[model samples]
Target: MSEVLTTDMDRDALNNDGFRLSVISSTAVLLEQFSAVYDNYPSYLEIFSPIKCQCGKLPVNNYPESLQKQIQRLVNNITEGMETQRKPLVMQKKKPPPLKMFEPKIEEVFDDRKKRKGGSKEINEKQKLVHKYKKEMKGAIREIRKDSYMIAQVQFQEQQEKYASFFLLTLTVLLLLSMGYKIKWL
Candidate 1:
């Protein structure tokens, strides 16, 4: 129930700062009049009670009928306007693309052995090619690791050198200050 109320509030024009300001400004006069009447009769039901208005003894009795009618009209108009102005800003959900079916291509290789001869030579050659590819891949991976390690070491050395230079400069400045060299810059 609270969630529903919150969602309604979120969609309300009064929640918008600019729209709320405009509505407040437009109803300033009505609000002031309502406030004055409200001051006498704090309860909403009491304000509309005929008994309260009919009694000439009470200050609330002075409340005019026309003011009540006007307030009612203003409230009705504001609610109608709010309903008309509310437009859904949320976008519609998109439908996903249709699924596609992919069929793998099947192939048959014919060798001399399939007929009546030997195919051992071809099998040996293919195996050798596979081993050669595996070795090349391993060598490439090892070289990449070595290059990365060397780069990291170079960066570390550079950082160390920078810190060392800064330390030495600070030490020299401290030594000079301690010796009372009377340097103009110091």
Candidate 2:
């Protein structure tokens, strides 16, 4: 900015004081320009047209090349410095704590065991009922089998008596015919 002011066609001496004054003036000009452009970047882009400075020169067009270079250097320095300042993030994966270590040996264990045993008393009674039903069903099946065997034996004896009676009737008729033939009663 200081270089920009001393760089005016009318300004001959470019001393430190002249440079300081020019910088101050350039700052004021820069503020105005920023405010105008700060409304929007597109608005700033519009102001890229020749900006006139108080030195009777267009500020943007007549801006000293050295000052533009200095501005570029300042921007690069700031960005690089900020990059160095950022700390590297190390992500740490946390593992869950070992699952509830070891079961406690307490009186509750004995109490639960006794309670479970007491409940099983009812289960024993139900089991007894199941056993009794099984025994009764087995006895009924045995009685049915014995009655079936007795009925079959009676039926077999009846069939044998019928066949014997038929054989005896046939024998008596043959004996009568033989006696008639011997008496010549043909």
Candidate 3:
């Protein structure tokens, strides 16, 4: 879905200061042609520029003495400017608060196992009592649910019988009215 823009087609579409960009297949040919036309074109393009090393220093030995100094100065200026632009890491030391210590007043009174041995019997009895109550409550709940279901069924049957009786009475009345004076009923 990308739109292709050609210099010929977009010549009048763009403003006067617009740049017409085209892909050059032969960069060496293009450079050579430009060099022949303009003698200082390579200086402006910096074709023989020195590459910066991993340590931020440029390889200036291949360049001339004047260019080596210029490159060194440029690298220094760049590093200085970067350092000035960056915020320095200010490390502040923090001291932790001291721990608190205290001494206990009371000493060992009696062995806890003896007390627990007597209390365990009472706890078992309480647990049995709670279990017995829970079983009885579950039985009572089941009985109550059964009784409620039976009551609901009885009420439903009574409603059905009432509806059937009302329907029969209405049918008999309608039949008698439709018969006019042709029927003889007591």
Candidate 4:
């Protein structure tokens, strides 16, 4: 007979169980603390309870029966453990110091105002310079556009003149060739 070896899947299951146990312990500790606090103020439990469930049943009822039983058992164990491990709670005598809020000094406010005024003046001067440069650039662009239009017009006129001259020269040569052929000048 051969013995079966445990695989990584088994290790994973063990790891998960360990993780679940840690989570349960931590949760139980928190619940234990909350229970103590709630005992001091019974109204807290009333406020913490769910108001209504959409399913018309308690939220816990939504869980499977076995899981619910397991949860109840876990809670019971936690309560027992807490009863054994927890120490008696003590009331505090001295309260923590109240927080101090920041208030700006008069001189600091005045200094900030002075700085803002100087900064605004510089900003205004830079804006005016920018506006001036923008106007100059726009004017330059307009002049360049006009010059380009004028150059294009001149080139078009030159092209038209060349075409017209070529047409007139061809007409004259054809007329001369016809006259020579009629006079028998081959």
Candidate 5:
């Protein structure tokens, strides 16, 4: 959500020391508009500006050159000012990022189907890539469903652990009380 910011863009940049630009839409038009007119790349135009909220899309690979420079400068200044933040930010925890856990790599999926001895015609390069990725995911999902025994085993083990913990707690309390009563000759 971009503010009108005085309905004046270039003028504001030239006149005022600080100017704000908010993305009105997350379309390429807004990106292109800024790219064509402003001296920045299409990517950083919105980010470099004082963005209040997401006007449309989240991020882009291409941004205005000036905007990119501004962002770089801002990041450099911040990093220089606060050297401590880099350690945790750059050298993250030992665990891999959360996203890595969910999906199997597309390459791994395709490698499993290497023995296609039957006739297989070549597909359009773009479509082949897309098809390969889709088939990989589709097959992985089907394979997961086929492993019902492993799934049931996991479920049974989870339930057993829950009951075992509950039983252990109850037995401990009983043992403590019985010992105390026996010590008093009850």
Candidate 6:
């Protein structure tokens, strides 16, 4: 077996085929040994049977008749114990309390009236302050708008002056050219 596995071949091919064949031969030997040991055994079925079903219950059908009956009895006893252990519910009649309207005391009402009078004065003062601030904000915004307008006017005037100067220079050049004056730069 070792000679058959270790022959001269490509390293990758040898590794794959050699490992596969060795595993297959080993599994075959194991299965043969297992079968020889259990083939004629009388309790082979009980030995190899599943201990529990897929749903986690004991495999009662796999067991002998007497054990199956005992398991059923135990299961019945456990279910009865669970049923008896539960608490019983009791029913009773209940009455809701009557509703009542809230009424303020005389002294509390007088105190609240006094607070309202003071609060009104404070509210008037706050309103006056808010009006003053609003007026100041409007004046500031107006001044900002006026300044931006003046800056825009100045920029427009500067651009107009630049174009006027350029036009005058071009006119002078054309006049000198028409008069047949040989300008050295030209």
lDDT of 6 by residue, 41-154 (tens): 554334323311211275556655755554454444333333333334666567666688698666633456333435577797887788799999999999999999999999
Cα lDDT tens digits for candidate 3, 1-186: 125555655655553322211111133235334434543332422432232232145344644575555545544533333333334567657766668769678888888854443557789788778879999999999999999999999999999999999999879878888988454568
Q: lDDT tens string, model 5, 1-186?
A: 135444576556645423222231233334444433443333343443433133224342355555555444444433333332322237645876566457655664455465443454554455668779999999999889879778999999999999999999879878988788432433
For candidate 5, the C-alpha RMSD (Å) to the true structure equals: 29.6
Weakest lDDT window of 10 consecutive positions for candidate 1: 51-60
Model 5 stretches with alpha carbons more than 4 Å out: 1-145, 181-186
lDDT of each: 0.60, 0.58, 0.55, 0.60, 0.52, 0.59
- What CA RMSD would you report for each candidate? 21.2, 25.7, 18.3, 17.6, 29.6, 19.1
lDDT of 2 by residue, 145-185 (tens): 99999999999999999989998977877797778843343
Pairing residues by index, what is the TM-score of model 6? 0.32
Cα deviation at 13, candidate 5, in Å, is 99
- Steric clash pairs (candidate 1): none
True-vs-predicted CA distance for residue 122, candidate 5, Å: 19
Ranking of all candidate structures by their TM-score, best first: 3, 4, 6, 2, 1, 5
**Deviating ranges (above 4 Å) for candidate 1:** 1-123, 180-186
The alpha-carbon lDDT assigned to residue 107 of candidate 6 equals 69
Q: How much is 34 displaced in model 2, in angstroms?
A: 99
Model 2: lDDT of residue 57: 48
RMSD of 1: 21.2
